[model samples]
Target: MRQRLAFALGYLRNPRHVGAIAPASRALAQAILAEVLRNDAQVLIEVGAGTGAITRALMPALDRLDRFLVIERDPGFARMLSAHFPELEVLNCCASSVDQLPLDASAPVTLVSSLPLLSMPKAEVQKCVSAMLSLMTHRPGSKLIQYTYAAPHLRPFANIPYGWRWRRVVSIWANLPPATVWSLEQTPRGASIVH
Candidate 1:
């Protein structure tokens, strides 16, 4: 109850930064993070990590010594994140500037974003996603995961030429307004040609 109240107050105070009123459920967050861990992604990038609810769930799912990078535009939340997860690399930056992230292309990266894409201007959201995709390692099995309360089919970047296949992985009704998980897989051109 305390956590929910804190999240509600946080969201009310800053809707743009908080994004959602309630943090994702532990079960749902774990399920999403598990998929990233399963892919053995060397680097994990989290955008809009408000209050680090997902971050809390993510840490246990990750390998003992994996590198996790979190980006939060809200200075207060960024400080909270830093205090909560001191070991992680927390950047007080926006998702749209994802390309500026200090990551290595030699390693595969899995981006987990909680940004409210449905609320943002389409062009801005597209730019951020595009930048993140560009930074991703083009390895055959690399992918990204995004969660939203809106319908999966209504996603703005559905037709983008990012060579990614977006699929709805799971839906959690137990959450405040319920949420859906969207997984993006980068399909190789050769494989697409064959199919």
Candidate 2:
């Protein structure tokens, strides 16, 4: 509780850096990360991994051979993440600069972001999303999982090209304000959007 309050206060003071008030609940964090792992994505990029609520759940789901890249802008949180999950390659950088990170091109990338997209400017949000999509190797089943405290359809990735489709995997009312997990998939050319 104290940590959550501190996070909230920090965010209130600096909205751009401290995206969200509280860390995700264990159940919601696990559920969100599980959707990405279920698709067998070899490389996973986690954005805004504040204090590593989802990171903790993500590590166990991945195999020893798999790689996890965690991007966090807050140095304090990044240091905490490094201390907690030394196995992961934690990058103290913004999500928009994801492409600049040293990632393995051979592996399929699946981006899972907890960044508060709605709170940020549209341009910044689009850039971050685009960067994530561009980083993917574009295999048969590459995906991006994003969780938000809003209705699934309401939070549109509008800047994304029509070739991509978003699906609501699950919703967790157990979370503080409740959150919906949305999976972004690239549809085949000329194929209808997948619900």
Candidate 3:
């Protein structure tokens, strides 16, 4: 109950960053967790984790992951998340700085993002998208799972990377305004390091 109120306040303060009035619904969180469980990843980084609604659901998979970094741009939300989940490595920073994190390149990474790409400023979006792509590209077998409020068929952003492809994972209508989950990954041929 308290979490809901804080999340609502967070949204009121910054509609674009918070994205939704309420935190991700139970169904939406479950859907994302299911996807995470299906894919075996060494490192799991969740970006735009507002108020940790999905973070609660992801706790179950904590045992399997070597590293779990929760990235929340909002300082208030980040502090709240850190307080709530002391076990997690919560970072208060923008999504565009993902590449700067001290991550192990040998470990496969799977980044779950809740950023509202379509509605954000284009320049910021491009920087974030490029950063995310670079992180995934450097770590072989890495993939990025992002959810958007856009149509189910839409790829999160256009420029499909060099060899990466987007696959629609699931469309969750139970959420506040509904959301579609999409994953960006290297095609089999693109899995190997080319540069």
Candidate 4:
């Protein structure tokens, strides 16, 4: 309940960033990450980690060698995440800077985003999607996971580069406003969107 209050206050402070009235329910978080496997990727990056709702869910699933990187733009939320999850490497910066992170080039990175893509400006969302794609190491199965309250058929980007594909995995109705999990995978250099 305390965490929910903090999340609500954060949302009130900046509706555009926080994006939701309450923290994500455990069920929603679980559904969003249902397909994630700790052994599939070397790095785990969670963007828009508001109050560690999804972070808490990802904690137990993470492999011992996985590098957990968290990106939170809000200073207050970042501080809270740092305090609550001392083991994680929290990066207090905008999600657009995902490509700028000092990551290992050879290691595959799996990104999980809680950002409000439907509410954010299209250009901003494009920038984030492009940056994330640019930064991912396409070692066969590297992918990105994101949940949205929008329609299940809505792809993150209408015209992405030739190598990426996104598909809706599941719709979780237990959340406050409900959401659908979208898994984006990086295929070969010339592959197109995966219907």
Among the numbered candidates, top lDDT falls to 3
CA-lDDT, candidates in order: 0.76, 0.77, 0.87, 0.80
Q: Write the per-residue lDDT of candidate 3 for residues 34-133, one digit (tens) a residue.
A: 9888788879999999889999999999999999999998999999999999999999999999988998866789899989887677798899889988
Compute each candidate's TM-score over C-alphas.
Answer: 0.86, 0.87, 0.93, 0.90
Models sorted by lDDT, best on top: 3, 4, 2, 1
CA RMSD of all predictions: 2.8, 2.4, 3.0, 2.4
Give the per-residue lDDT digits (tens) of candidate 1, residues 1-195: 756776787787777656676888887787787777767777788888887889998887556436789998778778889998998999998798887766565677788888888776678788888777777644445577888888645553555444666766888878766888877776657655111
Q: In candidate 1, how many Å is residue 38 off?
A: 2.2
Q: Report the C-alpha displacement of residue 40, candidate 3, in angstroms.
A: 1.7
What clash count goes with each model?
0, 0, 0, 0
Least well predicted 10-residue stretch by lDDT in candidate 3: 186-195
lDDT score of residue 168 within candidate 4: 77
lDDT of 4 by residue, 98-191 (tens): 9888877668778899989877777878888778877764444568888888776777556655676777788878787877888877655766
Tens-digit per-residue lDDT, 1-195, candidate 2: 755775676677678655565778998987976686577777788898887878888877668437788998888778888888888899998899987777565566778888888777778888887787777534445678888887756644665555778778888988876888888887768888754
Q: Give the TM-score of candidate 1.
A: 0.86
- Model 1 gets an lDDT of 0.76
* Candidate 1 wrong stretches, greater than 4 Å: 64-66, 137-140, 188-195
Give residue 66's lDDT in candidate 4 (0 to 100).
61
Better of 1 and 4 by lDDT: 4
